[model samples]
Every structure is written in C-alpha cells, then in structure tokens.
Target: MRTLTELLTITKNGRGRLVLVSAEEFFRLKSRDRRAVQPAELSDAELDLIAKAGMPVECAALDAEMKGYAL
Candidate 1:
C-alpha cells in the first residue's frame, strides 16, 4: 500500500498511460459505490495547489459504465 505521493511518483511519467484523477473525483467515485476503486489520498497542500493553479477538477472523466472495484 503506497501513499498517494508514492502512487503519483509511479504514475507521473506514465500519465499518458494512466489516469490522473483529482482528490474530489476520487471521493465522488467512492461515495457512489462502496466498492469503487478511488485513487489514493492527496495531501491538502497538493489539493490547494491544484485549485490555486486555476484548474477545476471534474470527475466527469469517470466512466459511467465503470463499476466500483478495490484499488
């Protein structure tokens, strides 16, 4: 079980090969399904930075057909 930072480190370069989701997206998915495979927890600092960067995160990228699964 790696932390969010660790997971980010692993996926950072493979961004084109992996999904990069925001913390909000992660939680919204989680609430919809108890079994949803939400992304790792991001630090508040990171979240704040993202918000400050003027990029509003949208979970709309999530596939509706994609069911919940453990990460």
Candidate 2:
C-alpha cells in the first residue's frame, strides 16, 4: 500500500485483522515478537470495522500512532 489510509482499507476488508509488513499499518504481529496479538487486544474502535467498510481502521490506528510521533 502507498499510504496508511490504504492499509486501513485492507484491515476493513479483513474484518478487523491485518498483516502489516509491506506498508504503513496497525501491526498485529510485531517484527521482533513473531507473535500474534488478538483482535480484543486492540482498541474497541479497531475491533469494530465491518467487512464492507465505510471508513478505514488504519485511520484510527494511525491517529493512535501519531500520538507518539514527531514531525
């Protein structure tokens, strides 16, 4: 995916689960851990996406990621 928004769309399509490696995404599997994090481990909103999404789950994840990032 070229952007975070696109990554989110993938998650929405995946029914709230996404494998993020080739793009900017909300990662269920950390590169270091090689372990899978449960959907319930995510924020309530992250777990709420429908298969046919009105918006991307990556948006919410990106927003959360931005909280700790600097320009």
Candidate 3:
C-alpha cells in the first residue's frame, strides 16, 4: 500500500521514472485487477540514450516488453 505522498517523495528524489497522472487515474490504477501500472512507452531519444549507455540489447528487450501493453 503506497500513499500518494510517498509516490511524490520518490519522484522528487529522481529514483524512478516520473509520470504526471490525475488523482482519478491513480485510484483507478490502484483498484485494478492487475496492481502494476505499466511503464510508459519510451521515446526514440530515450532509447538512443539507453543504447549509448551500452545497453542496446536491454533497451530492445524493454521495447518489446512495452509493446505487449500499449498505453
């Protein structure tokens, strides 16, 4: 059980990918049958950065995984 305040605190610390979501959206996600909120689709630029960081294979795998859940 994560409170909205804790979510905000984690985002502020730059610990994870941050997404701007409405309160309604947040609660809806919380009550979903699947508790995990899927990761956002990565942009070309972000993918390029990941590749440059020496993780081309990892980035490709991540892209493939995200394809399964199109937001």
Q: Largest lDDT belongs to which candidate?
A: 3
lDDT of each: 0.58, 0.55, 0.63
Per-residue lDDT for 1-71 in model 1, tens only? 54443323235564545655567667767788755333357677866886788423575456454668656
Error of 2 at 64 (Å): 38
Model 1 lDDT at residue 54: 49
- Higher-TM-score candidate of 2 and 3: 3
Clashing pairs in 3: none
Model 2: per-residue Cα lDDT over 1-71, one tens digit each:
25553443345654857544433333533444666688768676666653336646757766766786788
Number of clashing residue pairs, candidate 1:
0
Residue ranges of candidate 1 with Cα displaced over 4 Å: 1-16, 34-71
- Of candidate 3, the 10-residue stretch with the lowest lDDT total is 3-12
Candidate 1: C-alpha lDDT: 0.58
Off by over 4 Å in 2: 1-35, 50-71
TM-score of 1: 0.25
Task: State the weakest 10-residue window (summed lDDT) of model 2.
Answer: 22-31
10 residues in a row with least lDDT, candidate 1: 2-11
Candidate 2 structure lDDT: 0.55
Query: Which ranges of candidate 3 are over 4 A from the true structure?
Result: 1-16, 33-71
